[model samples]
Target: MHRSTRDIRLAEALVETADTLVDGFEAVHYLPRVADHCVRLLAARAAGFMLIDEDGTVSLTASGTHREVALDLLRAQRGGGPCLDSYSSGRPVPPVSIGAARAAARWPEFTERALAHDIAGTFAVPLRRHERLLGALNVFVATLPPETASPDDAASDDGTELRLAQLIADCAALGLQNHTAYVQCRTLAGQLQQALSSRVRIEQAKGMLAERWNTPADHAFVALRQYARRHQLPLDRVAQAVIDRVADDAELRRGARGGDDGGRA
Candidate 1:
């Protein structure tokens, strides 16, 4: 890709990441788009994203293609690949020659699997926000000559590609954090709305019971609460029942009489 064209695509990818912060953002869809952008912008054969769970298990979240997905799955299962290393260290893992004897020594199973898939080299950058590590992005190189397959290979020796990859990862991490906060805020707002609605229903029920029993609203509320406790039902449910005229009138009146006596005492 030309330098100018690649720059335009990079800007577009960053914008896409930011766009996901809005409502209705789906991680399942967004992650694959990010992985595809990585592969294209970095001129890599394949790319994938892996996320670490709260329980410390790393899993493949998305990939540029089915082949990359399989490789990512193998690496995650083996738990000793570049992506895992980057996530664990909270730093980028430089390009590693997958077929190297040293790589075999370091990550025997993963290296063997990657070589079998015709992957010559692998690079990884952590998806992190400062001290908080979320996951890692893996880049696969399919064809690197033996002479240039070292970690200091010309492909990324200048560090331009690595820096670009890290910038993309950082944008993704920030977008994910924003999405999580937006979801939490929406959930909290829903809970507050429900609570307010429930309070309104309860007040309406109290007024109805007070008029029916010819008693004060406070006494009627005591009766309603006692009925709910006796029936082992939620206060909200009982309130709704009173509003719907499904509550037992006789039982409520009995509770009202008891409340009256208590008030007198």
Candidate 2:
């Protein structure tokens, strides 16, 4: 591909990746798309990514193709490879020409699987923020270009490939961060809404008791609490029952008296 064309495509890919940082981002849907772009635009044969959850287990997040999906799972199952190395160390793993016997020897099981699957090269970059690592992005190349045919041969374009991988990984990291924050915010909002709803029900029930018996609102609240405690029901559920008239005024009066054998007046 012409240098100008490659540059334009690369810029476009970065823009597309960055656009996923919306309020309700879905990582499962976006990561694979990014992997596909890497294969198509970065001359990679395939691409896959792994995410390390809070529990420290590796999850195969996305793959550019079906073969890559299986291969990524194998790497995770084996527990050793460029992906883990990059994620654990927060560094980039240089492209390995898997076609070469020596290159394949570094990750023996991974190489065997790669050979079986017709994948001839692999590269990885970490998804990290400062010292915190989230996961790794991996790319599989069928064969290195002529000048860098040998794994030991350092090609000028290798740096470019590494940068592109890093760019994509950074985008994935940002999207994940945004998604996490969005979920937490939603959880908090839901909790607040539930609390407010419960409070409203309790207050409404108290008002009903106060008007029916000409008692103070404070005394009515005590009656609600005593009933909830004596019946072993949640305070909110009992309040709801009172509001719905499921609990009669006589029952509420008994509850107001504390449900004791020697009840309060």
Candidate 3:
């Protein structure tokens, strides 16, 4: 791709990443797009995302392609790779030759799997929101460009790519955080609504009981409370039963009388 065209595409990709912060952001769908962006816009042959779930288990969340998915799953199952290391350390892992002795020693299983897939080198950047680490983005390099053939030159170029990857990962982390907050807020709102509905039902039940027993609303409420306590039922549930006429009026009256007698004693 021409440099100007690639720059335009890069900007578009960043915009798409930022768009995920809006409503209806699905991580399963968004993550694969992130992986695809890395491969298309960066020096990555393939890309994948690994995330640490609530149980602290690291797993392959998404990948740019099936082959990359398999490679990421292997890393997750066997438990040591650039992605895992980056996520655990909350830092970037610079490009490392997959065939290097140190790579083999540090991640023997991962190195073997990566080599079998014809990947030459790999790097990782942690996904973070402020100081909190969410996951890591892995990029597989099939070969180095001629301009970065020397170790020093390769390191310098890798540094630039690493920063770009971190930028993408930062956007992903923000999207994830926003989605979490949205879900939590929705849950809280639902709970409040349910509480309000339950309160309305309880008040209705109180009025019905007062009319039926020819007693004050407060005394009727005491009867409902005593009945619920004796039956080991939720107060809302009992109130709902009263509203539904499922509870026997005579039985409740007897129970209320028993409570009054006990209080007098």
Q: lDDT value for candidate 3?
A: 0.76
Model 2 clashing residue pairs (backbone): none
**Best prediction by lDDT:** 1
Q: 1 or 3: which has the higher lDDT?
A: 1
What's the CA error at residue 41 for candidate 1, in Å? Answer: 0.8
Scored by CA lDDT, what does every candidate get? 0.78, 0.74, 0.76
Q: Compared to the true structure, candidate 2 yields what TM-score? A: 0.80
Taking every candidate in turn, the Cα RMSD to the unseen true structure, in Å, is: 5.0, 5.4, 5.4
For candidate 3, lDDT tens digit of each residue in 80-194? 8887789889999988888893444878778777777778888889988998888888888777668755432233477788887888889888878877888888889999999
- Model 2 spans with C-alpha error above 4 angstroms: 1-12, 15-26, 66-79, 99-104, 144-156, 257-265
Instruction: State model 1's lDDT.
Output: 0.78
Candidate 1 on 21-108: residue-level lDDT in tens? 5777888778888988887777667788888877887567555465554455446435477877898899998887776734448787
Model 3 lDDT, residue 50, Cα: 80
Score residue 264 of candidate 2 by CA lDDT: 24
Order of quality (lDDT): 1, 3, 2
